[model samples]
Target: MKGLVGNMGIAHLRYPTAGSSANSEAQPFYVNSPYGVVLAHNGNLVNAEKLKVHLDQDVHRHINTDSDSELLLNVFAAELEKKGKVRVNDEDIFTALEGVYKLCVGGYACVGMLAGYSLIGFRDPHGIRPLVFGTRTKADGAKDYMLSSESVVLKAQGFTEWRDILPGEAVIIPKDTMTPVFKQVTQPLSYSPDIFEYVYFARPDSVIDGISVYRSHLAMGDMLAENIAKRFGGRETLSDFIDVVIPVPDTARNAALQCAVNLDLPYREGFVKNRYIGRTFIMPNQKERKSSVRRKLNAMGLEFKGKNVLLVDDSIVRGTTSKEIVQMAREAGAKKVYFASCAPAIRYNHIYGIDLADTRALVGYGRNNQEIADVIGADDVIYQELDDLVKSVLASGNNDKITGFEVGVFTGEYITGVEAGYFKHLENLREYNARFKQNSILAGDDPKAEVDIGIYNEGDY
Candidate 1:
């Protein structure tokens, strides 16, 4: 391993948001094209089917996999091939990327090696996902630039100066030059970085698009606190309604603290999290998610024995986990249970890169506050408002760079345009997979059964 050598190399983790877990579908997907490119991307192409057709018919290229990242790589390759150069410079790369921005839709933050030529990176025009850039100087005083989906990596790796690569911006490091050049390939359009990154996806220590993720989470708590207060009169009346503020654990801790502070309630660790359990939200199927949820947290009966507990979570997607937690609270002898969400209701599918493809599976879909509370077995439910989410994040700083965020799941208006029938396509896929998942759960069989239309998982395609 120590003997491995290259001018530059890229490593990527495929989270399966838009592809299968097969080894063949893993990324840093390599392509022998205009200059021989190896590309890795963190996003899902909403128009991948259309792009595949275009690539085959218009560009005369073939996509070997159903992975959207592969389609994006081929698109980039085809565009570069159009430049009629075996080896190209930054200008050619940006021109080719402009073609990508025009034809492809949904979120993408891409990084790649242009063979022996250059290291290239770019983000979608709307910045639905995140990419941060950093620079460091070697002992000899030559500078090296790094790009990643999170800033914590750059910080951990000793990069001196780091910042977000803006939406529609491209950074190129030519093999010969070694100096990284930044180019705005597309117009400086309105940016709508995904709000969920701040809420769930990113590490709390990270900073995305110039906003500190930890602070954003804390601010979300602050907003949740404010909303909670308004729902139950002023802060003075909160204690009468709620005895203690509790977090679902890990992600919701910061927000829970803020909620407790604003409402003048005692903050308590009412639920003991089993750190060994993986996140239920990212699990592939309903059975895994439900099983993980049941095993992931244990109620502290001492805390909930006679208290009215208000539980805070980053978001409520399916509500299955919330119901389990609420039942745990009840079993622990709690007089009442209240649930609060730092994010608004998730009612629509996210075409960007998240695996939440079925609107029907969302607990908050078509349900009002009281209805959501009823479904989750909570005495009351509170969710952060859309405007407050924007305000809280903006207040953290960088009001100039990020004027707003993509609340597409909550608002159902994709920042990037979606073609007609896209929702229908997603629903059909999710329904097909849901049947298989349901059968697996009922039979207590292996959960990885395949559906008929499965090029991959329901959300990926």
Candidate 2:
């Protein structure tokens, strides 16, 4: 990417949600028509399958990949084509975005570049995804614009003046003028950013939708401490029950530390994380995820031996990692292992963007607190209450506009109401992918094989 030279460009690191993990499915997806536009999208579109059909039949646009991002790019292009303009302008781009908002449904934040014309950014009507932009003035007084899913990127690159792009809003920065035009292309349904951002996905340093991620984690810890105290009978009995608080690794560290401070328990780095190992929860298969947990973190005997240790993690998804970590703690001579999740039990599939396990595959699904504890081989399991989790995020920032959050994983009710049969469709896709992976392993094929299982395309039908 460093070798590529361009004054104005958009980039993306694909986290597979609505498509295959094939290299071809990666963004920034491009469309040659309607003035050579390229786009990078941050969230999943629930209506992608319907949109694909509309593009193919109504607009005559051919989609190459199974990616919804490609569908999104072509959607905007088709809308721009409707203008019948020889040369497009900022207004046309925003009008195209209005079409996109109307046609596409679900949580998405997008950044697009119109060839030799403009850079564009927009968000879903519900604001279930995060998008922010910032500007820096060049020495000649021309302003350089940047758009990202997080504020940290803008600040890191010295774009000091920044603000979140509002829900249902679009921003167009023309290359010729270098001036950005902002507009609310559609009426916002709600101002609900995904709560999972604070729990797992985002960097602690980044602020999303005016809420500081770091501060939210601290608040989560405070809430978790209160919950833990209740579990231990009272706040005064917390020290009697728990010997040490140990964070699972990087993401849980902040909350764990704050939890320890609130509970007056000693916080210890009980597990040494191997920085090279990628996050195990997002791993494609259960087998890989199960194996990677051991490689990712090693339990220190000194911290666990003869002690009643409380393990803190951001969240327990499939319980593969948590179960292994608990076993490791026991092997390290811990007398008792009490597991704590900073977020509530994630029982439903996260259709927004984060590719959590299927609903049935989740540890929390069809399980009470004790059942979950038994599955994870812990003495007890503590989950953050949904209300407390919401409060934790709300306590941190300018949350006046945010009346709620996209918490489908916890509640099974989404901001954009789920379409009929979508959950079944999503489950089928996941099962197919899992089977494909198993077959690849048996046949000794590349694990990352480019096998398309017809997720968002016409093939699914």
TM-score, each model? 0.91, 0.94
Give residue 282's error in model 2 in angstroms: 1.0
lDDT (10s digit) by residue, model 1, range 82-173 = 88965687888889999989888889999999878889989998888888889998999998888999989998989979878888999998
Indicate which candidate wins on lDDT: 2
The C-alpha stretches of model 1 lying farther than 4 A from their native spots are 1-3, 428-461
Q: Please, what are the lDDT tens digits per residue for candidate 2 over residues 1-461?
A: 67888789988985668666777677888878878989999888887778877988899888776577888889899999999988987778878788888899888999989889888899998898899989988789878889998899988998889999999999998887888899999988999999999899999999999999999999999999999999999987787789999999999999999999999999999999999999888899778998999899998899999999999999999999999999999999999999999999989999988778779999999999999999999999999999999999999998698869989899988889877777776775666566665664435322333633232433444
- Clashing residue pairs for model 2: none
lDDT for position 38 in model 1: 93
Q: How many clashes does the backbone of model 1 have?
A: 0
Task: Score each candidate by Cα lDDT.
Answer: 0.83, 0.88
Q: Which ten residues in a row have the lowest lDDT in candidate 1?
A: 452-461
The residue ranges of model 2 lying beyond 4 angstroms of the native Cα positions read 438-461
Q: Compare the candidates by TM-score and give the number of the best one.
A: 2
For model 1, name the residue pairs that clash. Answer: none
